[model samples]
Target chain A: MRAVVTVMLKDGVLDPQGKAIGQALHGLGFPQVGEVRAGKVIELTLDERDPQAARVAAEQMAKKLLANSVIERFEVEIVA
Target chain B: MRAVVTVMLKDGVLDPQGKAIGQALHGLGFPQVGEVRAGKVIELTLDERDPQAARVAAEQMAKKLLANSVIERFEVEIVA
Candidate 1:
């Protein structure tokens, strides 16, 4: 199975990198962009037998290493 | 409309950060992880009228700023 994990900064958390990118985008003429929050996407090919197992494993991976729970939230999607 | 943009490093690109995270995961006991690539996710609340227009705007955003075309690719999903 293939899974994609997206780890994103929680709302209200300060993101300097995202702010910088937003500013750059504004300078480049995309003024409609009001805010930008940057996160991480991790794609994995797993040997899990089912989507439920994949979700559990992915969550474990996120909590254990892929994300900092204090500031980030993660969502998992299983792809065929 | 709300949109999510996920930008990922193309295969064969060196991802030192991902490698470090993978190493940390290994140390933390997730040895099933063979490789890791880290990318970015951006969420936006757009005022676009339709999905097709939103897609065009998003692609322009990705090409102009959100992603580096040389090393990364982006996918956009509209939520409501």
Candidate 2:
């Protein structure tokens, strides 16, 4: 089974990386672009096969180590 | 309108970051985890209303700047 964990900064948190990217896009002529937020995706191929169990396990990982819950939020999605 | 650009490393490319993440997961007791791959997601708020046009523009951004085409592949998704 495969699980995807997406970690993104919390709302109102300052994201310098995202700001830099937004600036870069504007400079590149994508002036229609507005705000940008950068995040990370962790694709895990796990031995677990039960969809519900796999999602629970992946979410645990996201909360425990994959994300800094204080400043970030994570979503776990099961695929395949 | 909103767009998402997901950038992932190509197969056979060495991923030290993914390795480190896997190790950390193992240390945290998620031993069932097999191979882990790390990627990035850039969420953009765009002024464009047409979903197709937004996706095309986002893909261009991904190809030109968001991702390194030599070692990465990017997918652009349009969202409201």
C-alpha lDDT (0 to 100) for residue A56 of candidate 2: 93
Candidate 2 local lDDT, B1-80, one digit each (tens): 99989899998999899999999999999999999999999999999989999988999999889999999998888888
Estimate, for each residue in A1-80, the C-alpha lDDT of model 2 and write its tens digit. 99999899999999999999999999999999999999999999999979999999999999889999999999998998
> What clash count goes with each model?
0, 0
lDDT of 1 by residue, B1-80 (tens): 66778888888999898888778877887666667777888876567768887777777888888889899988998777
C-alpha DockQ of every model:
0.59, 0.94
Name the candidate that leads on lDDT.
Answer: 2
For model 1, residues A1-80, the per-residue Cα lDDT tens digits are 77788998998999898888778877887666667778888886666768888788878999887889999998998877
Question: Model 1: runs farther than 4 Å from truth?
Answer: none
Candidate 1 backbone collisions, by pair: none
Best candidate (score: TM-score): 2
Best by DockQ: 2
Which CAPRI quality tier does the interface of model 2 achieve? high
Give TM-score, chain B, model 2: 0.96
